[model samples]
Target chain A: AQTIHQWPVAEIKAVGSPLSLGCTIKGKSSPNLYWYWQATGGTLQQLFYSITVGQVESVVQLNLSASRPKDDQFILSTEKLLLSHSGFYLCAWSTREVFFGKGTRLTVV
Target chain B: GDKVKQSPSALSLQEGTNSALRCNFSIAATTVQWFLQNPRGSLMNLFYLVPGTKENGRLKSAFDSKESYSTLHIRDAQLEDSGTYFCAAEASSGSWQLIFGSGTQLTVMP
Candidate 1:
């Protein structure tokens, strides 16, 4: 069985603070990875996606970025956090069926 | 223009009844997929669709490539079926980026 893990399940950071959220996928190799952000009571929005190591594409520019440093690791980061960036962050991977992680709740105050 | 459009943004259905959700695509899609996001915030894979129809238990789905549309039918609705349903599609000629619908919030009433 495959599983995805996300860290810092819930976070509250001050405005303009640096942010980093991590994700790891187990039991899969070279799978397509994706990052999504859902605003409070808003629809799910695609943030970024990576096809392989060291490759990522931005789907929605929200002053955020993603990095695929390894086959099973994905990181979403930003240098300056904005109030609008607060939301639920989800990391997903697809081999044949798309699988999602538990998600991280970010609150910027 | 939105490549993927979902209907009935929200629905309230009585238990033991049946209802259907739809997704219309403006781009040429090669494959379609459905997902369920439960209240607990876990997104579960429902179906990975091909151009035709498929049935699993009380759920069924259909995708038409030429017409660029897909529909999800839920039968024998139960309280556990209440959640937000989403449909996504991958374009045949464009980037592998899968586009998702705004989602349909379904609530089952007793």
Candidate 2:
């Protein structure tokens, strides 16, 4: 069975601070990775997707970027965080069907 | 315009009753997937359909590409079924990019 793990289940950071969120998929090799963001009480928006290592595609410009440093690892980061950046961050992996992680709840103060 | 529109933004169901959720797509969707987001914000896949019907336990779903719509049927609804149900579709061929609906929040009452 494959499992997806996301780091720092929740975070509270000050605005303008750097942020880095990580996700890793175990038991699956070369799977497609994606990052989705959901604002409070809003529908989800796709931020980025990576089909292979070292190549990432941006879906919507949300002042964030994603990188697939390894085949099973995908990272979401930004140089500075904004007040509007606070929301739920989800990491998903797909082969035939898509699967999402528990997600990280971000609170920017 | 909303590419994917879900009906009945909210619903209240009585236990043991049956209900159906629907999604209409304005985009050219090739596949559809249904998901349930629990109160804790964790999304669980309920169904993946390719212009056909699928049944699992008391839940059944059907997708019609020709009609550009999909429906999810829940039979013998339980309290645990209370959640925000979302239907997503792949807008393009083999894009793998899922466009989600606004969702239907279902509250099952005893």
Q: Which numbered prediction scores highest in TM-score against the true structure?
A: 2
Q: What docking class should model 2 receive?
A: medium
Give TM-score, chain B, model 2: 0.98
Mark the regions of model 2 whose C-alpha exceeds 4 Å error after superposition. Answer: none
> Looking at model 1 chain B, which ten-residue stretch has the lowest summed lDDT?
B90-99
DockQ of each: 0.66, 0.77
Error of 2 at B57 (Å): 1.1
Q: Which candidate number would show the highest DockQ if scored against the true structure?
A: 2
Chain A TM-score values, per prediction: 0.98, 0.98
Candidate 1: residue pairs that collide: none
lDDT of 1 by residue, B44-105 (tens): 88999879999999999999998889999999999999999999988763364778899999
lDDT of 1 at A51: 86
The weakest ten consecutive residues by lDDT in model 2 chain A span A40-49
Give the per-residue lDDT digits (tens) of candidate 1, residues A1-109: 8889999899999999999999999999899999989886667788998989999999989999899999999999999999999999999998656678999999999
- Estimate, for each residue in A1-109, the C-alpha lDDT of model 2 and write its tens digit: 9999999899999999999999999999999999999998778888888989999999999899899999999999999999999999999999868999999999999
